[model samples]
Target chain A: MNTTATLSRIFAGIQPELDQVDALFQERATSGLAILNSASMHALASPGKRLRTALTLLAGKLNHYDFGKLLQLSVAFEMVHLATLIHDDIIDEAATRRGNPTVNALWGDKIAILLGDYYLAKTSGLIAEIENPRIDHLFADTVATVCEGTIMEMMTSGRADLTVETYFEKIKNKTACLIAACSKGGAILSDATDEQVEFLHSYGLNLGIAFQIIDDILDYTEDQSTIGKPAGNDLRQGMVTLPLIFALQEASQNGHQQQVQALLNSDEHNEKDILEVVDWVTHGYGVDLSLQEAHNYANKAREALYHFPASSDRDVLDELIDFVISRRR
Target chain B: MNTTATLSRIFAGIQPELDQVDALFQERATSGLAILNSASMHALASPGKRLRTALTLLAGKLNHYDFGKLLQLSVAFEMVHLATLIHDDIIDEAATRRGNPTVNALWGDKIAILLGDYYLAKTSGLIAEIENPRIDHLFADTVATVCEGTIMEMMTSGRADLTVETYFEKIKNKTACLIAACSKGGAILSDATDEQVEFLHSYGLNLGIAFQIIDDILDYTEDQSTIGKPAGNDLRQGMVTLPLIFALQEASQNGHQQQVQALLNSDEHNEKDILEVVDWVTHGYGVDLSLQEAHNYANKAREALYHFPASSDRDVLDELIDFVISRRR
Candidate 1:
């Protein structure tokens, strides 16, 4: 099945709740100021796949499934995801995201920065409404981890010697931690047992790892029309992701290491150089190896479901792992 | 007395606790990444006056005087203050703060932005340790208000027809709200009565208004050597603070309104035009009228303290009002 159909199938159970989440998010994003309101509405218009929202809602389904609390949690998580994307666009100097102009591109960095902070503050207020200290602490720690991960990526940019361990660490912090928080937080909101929360956390963490690994792989294999960014965009930005790391490891033994290193080390890389490296990573075993690793985590995510009894909710979560692995974008 | 001696007298009771707050801040700022660690340390090195921290500590003195909780609140407030300053420097395109290079100046805006987010995240974690839902909501709402105020300021920049009421609203949101949070939070931590909290909040709100007005006044009156920046810096940046607003009002009666409006509406302000406006505001009734407004607020702050019984803490808090109004810088 195609990505859209698969997501539709997976999200069918919680579609109403998801809509409510969107509604709440829109309400919160609206400000009295014209500029702020317009910029926020623009950001809200080009929504992502809402994977985190789905995760939160689906995780809540395993137990009590309190829609009120679950809706708030989903909206807060989505706001955080959007806020990070706004700031990330500023850092990347990105003109567009998901085929739309970024907040930083439409407005300016100053306004974009403040808008991101506003979303975060809104998230805090929403979490406080939940009246759960544990959730508050978890969300706080996750944001800090996300900041650290992004900093690590910025600091390690252009370094060809980045280890696979550091790559996992960085992606885990940048992406997986928040995804894990979504599931864990949802489970906590439903008053799930510690064991149940642990299992859901594990499932989300592994799924998130697979999700990001696929994202990195698409940077090599997919075109701009499909991926919403040019192929080899990551390489051009000096981000050494999983495929590039694997390709570099293989290139060191195959005598292509020096050429790649020179390109990475240079202040300005030509488009041709980037395409050449993209060809090597895509045509070689790098893409295949990375996909294999993504499947490994996907399987681990599936395994985590065994702890819960058979239910339609578990089935949707189970299918989500496959959707995460198979999606093109 | 000199500013130093006055502050020393006020802080004598809480000096040890202030030192502990500083120590804890340093430890939290130390990161594993070299670039992040160094950038954070550079920001930490040039500490601000810690007005928020002092407010938190002094307010806590009214009731329980719980050092542990007050310390956490104090540090968190200080971090929030510093984080806003870092982002503010980016918005201002400022190169130096407190006669030291800004994070943006030293490490670029991207790093500065991340560092600011990092501090805010740390603040969330600290507030979580306190485990108070009300405080959490307060901090979050205050942060959102601060962002809104900043966005309002940016949107209204260079508008010569800005109203006095709008100026008051902007300053209250951008400055007074957070300062008010510090006192309110400290009161909450120390188990003060709701009435006491309200009084402290009033004290903070009024003092904050007076503080910002004096700051605006100093921008026109003090030279670079005294104020750590050039005179008329706000006017040069098209800020339209209280003094300038008052001057614009006065200028309309004297037939100089059109000339000042041209300077404000221009895309780029030359030094001479800025100095001319600064001279008019300082030499005319603008400064005196603005000072009277500040004193009105300062007196309100003092009146708020009448509800509290006599204590050294009350004395210190009262003395702070004089220190705020009289300081040259």
Candidate 2:
């Protein structure tokens, strides 16, 4: 969690600014509404790596971004992230996140849903403070796009005919669009040229796709502790991620698709078979293939930043391409 | 369902405009996201009487409201209503709303939550189009307030010592604030005087409180076919509404507190006793007393409209105060 070990060294200029963003994010998330304040306080206490917030800050460094508006928009982006995660836990019926009691675990799905909604409101409220109609519309539209992505994923869940293209579409909606919104928003607030904004948006989108690919890959490569939940829970929930999708494609090519199909069809009580699938995915070229895809997106993200003048901020943004792919969690 | 019997004659002026609002609401609810579109289209098909929408339209009649902005805001209000209902079904574990399949019932809680979130995004997106910062802030704050109210209600779900103050607070949040937002938004969009805006706000708040009180009353008094759920479902779900609160107070005074307490304490086996409590409440002036409180709120709501001169729109608005109190469902 000591991003200072990595990002701090590269972001010597905006480190203090990043810290202020963190402080304000923590403060703003604590609402005057008692339940939201307490629940969000609990959730924000075990914060994510703030990769999204840092993305906004780094993108802002591309031009003369208003610090205040940037901080507010950054908070808005993180709250959107929090709101989705809170709702996701309810859908996943997850009891914990990163070993901390999920909102649903602490308070039932009822409170969890409401608290998620509270975060949604806070997200809107923060964006409204910025009073930028274009940004507000972007955030709202991104929210719908995110929902669309997940709903499509659910619609295709447990199906035998999951396509590679459909999987990319799902991940783009579920993960990448919000990342693009964050960077695009930051760039919009900055005195950046249209080219710079377009570049950052593309950078964020590519990086987001790459980040989620690695995350899906980690579901099999990493242990429970490193990944924060049981390994292969996605498969357990009948969700097919990139690694599993790639692995299944390989299985079909090798004519072992029947075994993989049997594993997919079996609901539970197929621990030995589940392990077999995991082994096929890990020991085979599944991890390698997925990592290759991630590397490709990360390279594209790097290329998107090719036109930007080299600065400490742009340098750190470029380094995130590697950090996103290499990080354990 | 035939609003014609009541509002048609009075709303001849705004008939076409209201139709436009409905058409746009239907059009906007559908998304490129098929699941969201289908689910929302289904929910919108079984729409409530659009009491909240009517309130905005009727309030707009007070002055020269921007028909475009008012229509958009009204649709936004309704979407907010729809979103809350979608999530509330998850909380209530309700299979149907108004005798139609709830999103949760058809697609399970995960899809239901996601669809509800999509509606929320649509809500914010619609408001962002209006480009009014104060109105935007009001809607966002209203959402948080609504969540706070519902969370508090869930927190106090099954207590022997539920306070009337707390009960009012819950209804005000769960039901009233959005109504207030609708009317306030209407007034804001209109060329209404500031005093007129204040009056409409008060009218909305009081009317909303009355509307919910009657709704709770209907839960006990109406049959399953009428209310869309079983009679006394509120108490069955460990929820204490206005009628039950009054019934418990009466039982205490009449020395039948143990009977009421026993029924509340019992799980599901005491259907007979629950019926007995309902009988006692219904046959024993519970409905009368609850209606009396509703009448009080209705009178206050009417008082807010006293300053408005005679007009058909005002006439309809005045009649709604009584309609909310007198109507069965």
Residue-wise C-alpha lDDT for candidate 2, range B8-58, written one tens digit per residue: 555566778878888999998997767776787789886454777888888
State the C-alpha RMSD over the true interface residues for candidate 1, after superposing those residues.
0.7
- Estimate, for each residue in A7-73, the C-alpha lDDT of model 1 and write its tens digit: 8777887888778888998998887888878988898886454789999998999988799998999
Query: What local lDDT score does residue A327 receive in model 2, on the 0 to 100 scale?
Result: 80
- Misplaced by over 4 Å in model 1 are A1-5, B1-5, B253-255
Single-chain TM-score of chain A, each candidate = 0.97, 0.94
Range of the 10 consecutive residues with the lowest summed lDDT in candidate 1 chain A? A252-261
Provide the overall lDDT of each model, using Cα atoms, as 2-decimal numbers: 0.88, 0.83
Compare the candidates by DockQ and give the number of the best one.
1
Best by lDDT: 1
Off by over 4 Å in 2: A1-13, A31-35, A252-254, B1-12, B251-258
Cα deviation of B195, candidate 1, in Å: 1.6
TM-score to true structure, per model: 0.97, 0.95
